[model samples]
Target: MTLYKIDEVASECNLTKRTIRYYEEIGLLSPQRSEGNTRLYTREDIERLKKIISARDVLGFSLQELHRYIEVVEMLTGQRERYRSITDLEERRRQLEEIDDTLGKQLDMMESKMRTIQSFKEEAEQLRQQVREGMERLGRQSVERAEAEH
Candidate 1:
């Protein structure tokens, strides 16, 4: 049950203290408070912040999207816990369905981001192709001018 201060947590997570506080302000994190109203972070809180960082920086999720992603992940975690405790066949089936639904939401968000990245790549390739064509055209005109001069 190790507790960490905000500075320690930020350094461990490679984030600024203000960024960590901002995440808390946006409901993405909720570290416990100390007796003096200072924010105290647990190992779990640090882990959650790492996930938030990954979602925002690696996955390029906007704040709104990150909120939804965290909500789905939390729901799935709870559903998994409930699933292990349930014994009835119907209840287990329902739990599985809920888990699947949560997973689908996450997958949808990832797919949308992938599509956007792919679109950007395609546009970049088109621009590169146009540049290549323009260069080739210029080279041909240069040769033609030299020939005409000669």
Candidate 2:
């Protein structure tokens, strides 16, 4: 197995050495050690780090949640590799379907909210125009009356 120094791994992943070490300390990664106590990372380790960071920052998962997902992925990988479990595949498919459904619902809700806001803005604009017209009419009437009285 080819070993990568901390700098090499950081450069490959576009993250700082401190961040990588912190992730390892926090149980997010488990890079192997060489004979000289150097950290050696496999391709799988890099992929896992990518997943962890993306899940936390992009998908808004907490560290604990991301850790759980990493464990799940690891377990699924093992099961698929060793046992070739069809049930695990089916479960993953179901989970993805549920995620799609939830995302669709959220999109619908956001669209509804946007429509409501647009309607309110239109109504407010119409009311403001009416108020302006009413004021102008009242001012003209008052001026004519004053002139006639004078």
Candidate 3:
């Protein structure tokens, strides 16, 4: 049971201490405590923080979104464990298949969300270009008007 202090976790993960604390405040992380009440993080906590960071940085997920994603993943994993423990062969097979299908659907939805994010970026870029072009045209119009008035 290797445990790391808050500072070590922050340094190893390249995260600010404040950010790690904020994740704890937001119910995203739960680290154990030392006998002296100091924050002691296990490997699981470190991994979870890294997972959250990856979701945020690589996938561009908002904090709320990442929190919900973690919750859903944990719930599904728990459900998987329960289904795997069933003794009856037929029932176990049915439950396992259902869980598998649900997981597949969840993955499909995430892929769709990624595609939507890409589309949003493209739309924003296009609108930015339009705004820039409009501003240039307005500037030219203003110059012409000033020259005529002179």
Using lDDT, give the best candidate's number.
1
Number of the predicted model whose TM-score against the real structure is largest? 1
Model 3 Cα shift for residue 129 (angstroms): 7.7
Tens-place lDDT digits, model 1, residues 83-145 = 999999999999999899889989999999989989999999999999999999999999999
Runs of candidate 2 with Cα error greater than 4 angstroms are: 83-150
lDDT of 2 by residue, 1-150 (tens): 666778888998899999999999999999998888888888888888988887666555667767766766675555444443345877767655655655565455446656776899899999999999999999999999999999
Candidate 3 lDDT, 110-137, residue by residue in tens? 7877998989999999999999999999
- Give residue 49's error in model 1 in angstroms: 0.8
CA RMSD of each candidate after superposition:
1.2, 9.7, 4.5
lDDT of 3: 0.87
What does candidate 3 score in Cα RMSD to the true structure? Answer: 4.5
Task: For candidate 3, list the clashing residue pairs, or say none.
Answer: none
TM-score between model 2 and native:
0.54
For residue 1, model 2's alpha carbon misses the true position, in angstroms, by 2.8
Ordered by TM-score, highest first, the candidates read 1, 3, 2
For candidate 2, list the clashing residue pairs, or say none. none
List per-prediction Cα lDDT, in the order shown. 0.93, 0.76, 0.87
